[model samples]
Target: MPIDLSLLDDDQRIAATAPRGPVCILAGAGTGKTRTITYRIAHLIDQGAVSPNKVLAVTFTQRAAGEMRDRLRAMGAVGVQACTFHAAAMRQLRYFWPQVAGDLPWRLLDNKFPLVARAARAAGLSTGKDMVRDLLGEIEWAKSSVIGADEYPQRVAEQRRTPPADADKVAAAYRLYEESKSSPDGMLLDFDDLLLHIAGALENAPAVAEEFRAQYHSFVVDEYQDVTPLQQRVLEGWLGQRDDLTVVGDANQTIYSFTGATPDYLLNFSRTYEHATVVKLQRDYRSTPQITELANTVIGKAVGRAAGTRLHLEGMRPAGPAPTYHSYDDEPTEAREVAAAIRGLIADGVPAREIAVLYRINAQSAALESALADAGIVYQVRGGEGFFHRPEIKEAIAALVRAARRDDLPEDPVAVARAAFAPLGLTRNVPEGAQARERWQTLSALVDLISDIVAGKEAASLVDVLRSLRQRAEAKQAPAVDGVTLASLHAAKGLEWDAVFLVGLVENTLPISYAVKAGTEEIEEERRLFYVGVTRAREHLHLSWALARQEGGRKSRSRSRFLDGIAPDLEVESSPQRLKRARTCRVCGTPLETPADKALARHQSCEPDYNEDAYLALKAWRLETAREAQRPAFMVFSDASLMAITEAMPATPAELLDVPGVGPMKVEAFGPGVLETLAPFRSG
Candidate 1:
């Protein structure tokens, strides 16, 4: 039976039906981008345009790939291969290793931390564990960008990145690590080496490359904006000049630039393929109109190169309560209020699991977690020791992976999984406590996936099943357990919850003090990070900042300047003390019903005591002046500038140029209009 295409929106339908060339789907948050990709796959198979077996779908994480496969199966589009970049490369390398070279080198090392530590010690560097970890991370990053140890210093310098204090020592350690990897008796390939080797093989071996491309006729990539340059090169090698590709991502959410991922590829997709079909999915079904507006307004300030024609999202959902903003006297008060709000939300029928508390840095979680615990609320740190990384779970998976290597294909992979976990006190029978039950459920889900793959003929061997499980584990994709989630903004990417508490919106937190000094790129990424956090909310969003915090001692702080960048009309601020007077529209003296109403009124009514007509006239003149100058209206004179102009009633060009954001350059251009616009409000 063919799947129904009627469910998709018109733009989505167009994206799904774009024929066989480079297609870029600019999907915003909650725009059903996933649905479009899955439907496109189903359509390709159902329409006999491409065999399900010949389609290769790639996602950033194993969890995403698994979800895609599940969705495809539901749509009756079976046999499609969905996997992460590393998984795909590993499979190809494993299958063609013999033909390309001789036997494969040493087995894949699961953890490189210990090896790195050993290398550091071998290099006579007695660094702390944290320093060693940082060194190892730098090495991994260098490798991911295809930079070898020899080229590390030069690349670091060119990028303007500060070299490690002990740069030579770290480099020596890195070289030692590389030598250990290529030892005569053994050699090890880490996760990134999988992509690096596969790309190299395809580049050098034309026959292998041709055969691989011929085998997989169609390609679909999810989260394309988070792809690194090396990954893009791999995709190019896989395509081999064939434009049978569909890439979907949001450029505005490109917060992983630090990890070598760039949104340039996604943003420039049309430029790369002149004939590529580009479609924008703007209808956001997740957030309220107020929330969507705030998201759009926040990202609009992004001056980064990747910030293209602001793809503003149109909210399809009904308007909800305006996102609340709060200012606290101290960090403890902020945490307490956030906790109280969570309790209130749960009391109001929002599930605890549906609520999440997000912060800019992991350190901020300490207070929030403490507050939640005091309130008897169960919460899980999103990226901290996920289900697949749990000690017991890792042991069980190791046993299952070993069993999968044996030619004996078990009828019930779930049963094998059960046996593997039995030693760890995890079994098919019901577990005792809530936590145990959850763990058992996660294991059962993993086994069920393997069983389904086997039953559906998606796996040709037990090894393949093992490989799939291992890949998913490495990808850190775990089932969503029932608990309030606490995560850093970076870890919360590609995930959402009902109510989000964006705590720690203070100055040194959001834009972060280090990012402020780092330069424009860092600041831009920080803004993108804030955008990611805001868009994660499907319903209620609360942004909060503390005026003071007590770590060593009470220190005064202010709200982030990024918050200041958000259009004045998007947020309303509040504190413990209620407003002494009723908030009324300054223009008409009407009571403001809500924060959204107040924000709108504030934007509309600048300088309430002054002549209203003068403010309006000044705004009109500023708009016209901006249009004439081919600049944003704010450049001509900010709303604040207009408000000042209306109040001061600057009659002369010199006085008009004295207004904020107006300089000598402005006096040569729009100063006369500024004076003329102010004349109506000026008393002769």
Candidate 2:
């Protein structure tokens, strides 16, 4: 079948049919880069310029490689090789290892943590899990950048890297790790080693390099912006001075610099191959105009090399709702209110699966998970285990169950639960380090669950509280297939949703403290990350931040500086403008003078006629209803709604619906109970 050029835009068509020496496609977010590249390969095959068997397509992930193969096959272009850099290198290494080393291929190291811990022990360094993980990360960075143990310290200084430990200690650990891997008894090869070994083999072994180079005549590399130095060396070996290559990437999406990946290769492609065909894909088909506009605005503020080459995405879709900005008093309030807004969207007919709540870090998911569960909304965590399935949470639950089985339980279930998690390092102050902080957040969420359970019950026993927890755990075990997605921004890349909530957009969290300290380049990467998060929304985009980490804590946090030009009318507590807009009475429009008036949003003289008995009765009913439903009391009815009910004394369902705060959904849910609560106080 002849390749159809009609399917592609003008730029895509030009890129697909361009002369095949060297081609570069700068694909922005939502651009049809994948389709363009696939069609380009098919077009080349159809034109008899390249054989399908000799074309190798390399991407960043197994999933992406699989998708590429599937698309090529669907387009009637089969026999093309599509795989990740490691996968491609591993195949060649496996074939040549017997000839080169006179032994079976080394067993691939599945988990590096154990090996890293052993290396740490050998080096006389800390063997804690966090330290081990950090050490492994540093080692991987060093190896992937093609820097050996001896050169690690110098490279760290040159790159301005903040090592997990002292530079000398990290170098020692890296040395030990390499020595252990190369020992006679220990034949282990990690993912990075696969590339390093192959690159070396091609450079040293002429027969192996000749055979590998002869196997492929053309190459297509996706996500070229993420190519690390080691991967680039491997690619060069495969090319063997040939320029038959096409690379596709977007510099704005280069968020993995810390992992040794760089956009320099993509940015400097033309410098290496002077005759390369360069094409830019800027038309975005994923999001609406409003979303793309915000995306452009966010990226427009970015500076530095990657940002200088950024593509300004042009949305092809119709206009959508403008992105919203929200400010909350505290983190818990932000989570709860965001959950409430999600529930409202679902009620408005948006599929739960079409929504997402993206945060800056993995630890931020705990509070959001609790809030969604309390709102009776189902959510699945991406790139990590579900809240209940987390190891720490499971351990806490097991401890609680064992304690409940004991006969010497305290009257306060909260006390029992707290004591159960105390051994797990549950404390008022959050611990330092990434792993410890995540553990603390998970345990803190469990404690908060206990408090909510006890608050809802009249006189809850340990057994009853444990049962409720067990029920909640069970519910969280198998989340609904179509549940809201809770993911960190990094995990949310390459995916989009109808409604996206970019929560926890405070300074220390989004740009992050480390990025702030790392200087301008890292800060620019964070800004690009923010741009990535903004583009994930197809229609509704909500960006929110909190004034404080916890309730009653100091309101010292500020919104991310990236939002300075994008979000309108952002008012922090300390802002003089915020102070100027004083609290006012709802009825009289007069500035409130006292704390009582501010709390009530009205002056005492402007207060409506009160009925204490009716108000108390309604409040009791709301509490009982919320307890039975296992929901927050505010979800059932806010205090303002209860006050409106008390003042109106609505006797019928229609009259109850007439209350300002009451809507059709509320009337359908609790109308009869509300009417009965106000029956005796009716004037009629």
Candidate 3:
């Protein structure tokens, strides 16, 4: 059978037909790398270079592996083993464990959290959920980086990692975790241990290595940039000393560094195998010219190992609309406006499913979910549940339903809901850790929904709110599968849409504050992440950022640095410029002399002489009002507004409206209580 080269581009054809010892295809995003790799496998088989059964193709995901197999089958190249590294390792381990280890293999531990908790107890560390999750992440990173328990502390320091616990404790927990896996009561092997055991087996047993090498004569690794050190060791073990290998990846798409994946192997492939055929596939067929240019610019600024090998993608598609930039006063405004834009795009004949809103983190979805719901738009969150289907939201809804059935039901449904949710960890301050913050955001969204419901219909009871929630959830789960997509940027990789709304582009969120602290390599990875998000767009690309976390908060945030060089008409302030700016007193219009004055934005003498009693009363009233309305207390009236009112002693409606944060709508909603609270402290 003749393998056709007619369908491949020049670069692709070259990569597909390259002579077989060691080949590295530097395939940029949307460059048809998969097709080229499959073609190469078929060509190898057709050329009689390797038997189909003796060729092994490995990728990062099971779906990708399946697709590779499917493609190979379509090309008349069957019997080749296509699977993930873990799958291949597990298969080999299953077959050879009895012969090598003198007994049947241990049960594979599907979830490591329970065992991690046990390990934490043995190590005298905190067993909190977030702590355990972080520790598990650390242990996995250490294992993937090929660092042993004894070396974990030094590695943590070298890597400048902010571990969940002290380095010694984390290492202790890791050691205990390893010990527990082999204990008499606990005969378990985790996913990481699979690769380790297999590598160890091959290293210790020459006969096993010989048999394994003889089993697979040729190998193809996809997404080679994401191969961890541990996976690399297993690959090395499998190869013995053979160099008949093909690795295809884009160094710019190397965004999984936190998972211990690195691009060193892919970048250094030619150096490692001096005669390896290195082919660069630069033409991007997924995005438009505007998008490709943006993607190139994003990665062009990267300054690290990946930068040296970054592929300058050429857009193969026709020119499209220039990417748009947006700035918002606050996050809610950003989400609302972005959702509105998505709705408008859908109205302009774009299919709802063809538009997506991507953000930096999972917690960012809660606001977008609310705004989309408010706009009467349907959406599905990719790589996660729709907002209503989240565990925290479901738990909150159940609690609300339980409260609705109470015999001593309060007049205010919001109060009943708050009292019910309080025990479940609903708080004013957002919790630490990604998992906990996401949970808090979900609960907070629920509270916001209840507020909206009650505000829309003053007569709505606790039962009515629950009914509304149920209706919303049902609507989301309806047969309309063409809803818009809401996803995190990381989740949006390898996915494309006609229109993309890249929201939450603020400095702290995108580069993310921690990435900034982690030094240049992490920052470069963040840049590549932005490039990945940008390349995900086919035509319409809308980038946006907000200046504040909440509606009335100070406009203190800056747009992501990745956007500084790309976005037009935007003057981004450098760190030095931002720091050098003077803080002036809001009351006197003069420079602040002290840190406290600067923080308060007012001098001591210029500060408003507010009535403390009246301010306290207003706070209490705000809390009760928030509970009754099923809203965050800050939404009722920020403490600043309360203080302003007490100081100004707003006696009439007009005066109350003059105070900051006290708008007409708020004055109309809770005016009576606010005025009443200030009455006792009024000056004669």
- Judging by lDDT against the true structure, name the best candidate: 2
* Model 3 lDDT on a 0 to 1 scale: 0.83
Candidate 2 minimal-lDDT segment of 10 residues: 427-436
lDDT of 2 by residue, 1-684 (tens): 798799899999999998779999999999999999999999999999999999999999888899999999999999999999999988889998876677644889989888789989888888976678778888888888999999889889998888878888889999988877776664799999999989999998999888988889999999999999999999999999899999999999999998899999999999999999999999999999888998998999888887667799999999888889999887878999999999999999999999999988876886788788879898899988877788888888898889878875456767677667766757434554445556766787677667766765733987887777777667665355889999989999888899999999989777978688779998998998998899888889999998866665567777899999777765665565324456677778889999877656579788545776777788899999999999999889988878887877876765675565565567778998988877877753
Clash count of each predicted structure: 0, 0, 0
Q: Candidate 1 — which pairs collide?
A: none
TM-scores of the candidates are 0.69, 0.78, 0.81
The better-scoring model by TM-score among 1 and 2 is: 2
TM-score of candidate 3 versus the correct structure, residues matched by position:
0.81
Give the distance in Å from residue 6's predicted Cα in candidate 2 to where it truly belongs.
0.7
Model 3 C-alpha RMSD to native: 7.9
Candidates 1 and 3, the one with greater TM-score: 3
Error of 1 at 330 (Å): 0.9
Task: Write down the RMSD of all candidates, one decimal each.
Answer: 23.0, 14.4, 7.9
Q: Give me the displacement of residue 330 in model 3, in angstroms.
A: 3.4
Error of 3 at 535 (Å): 0.7
- The TM-score measured for candidate 1 stands at 0.69
Candidate 3: lDDT of 525?
A: 83
Instruction: Give the Å error, residue 378, model 1.
Output: 2.4
Q: Which stretches of candidate 3 lie over 4 Å from their true place?
A: 374-376, 395-434, 437-474, 478-480, 550-554, 570-608, 611-684
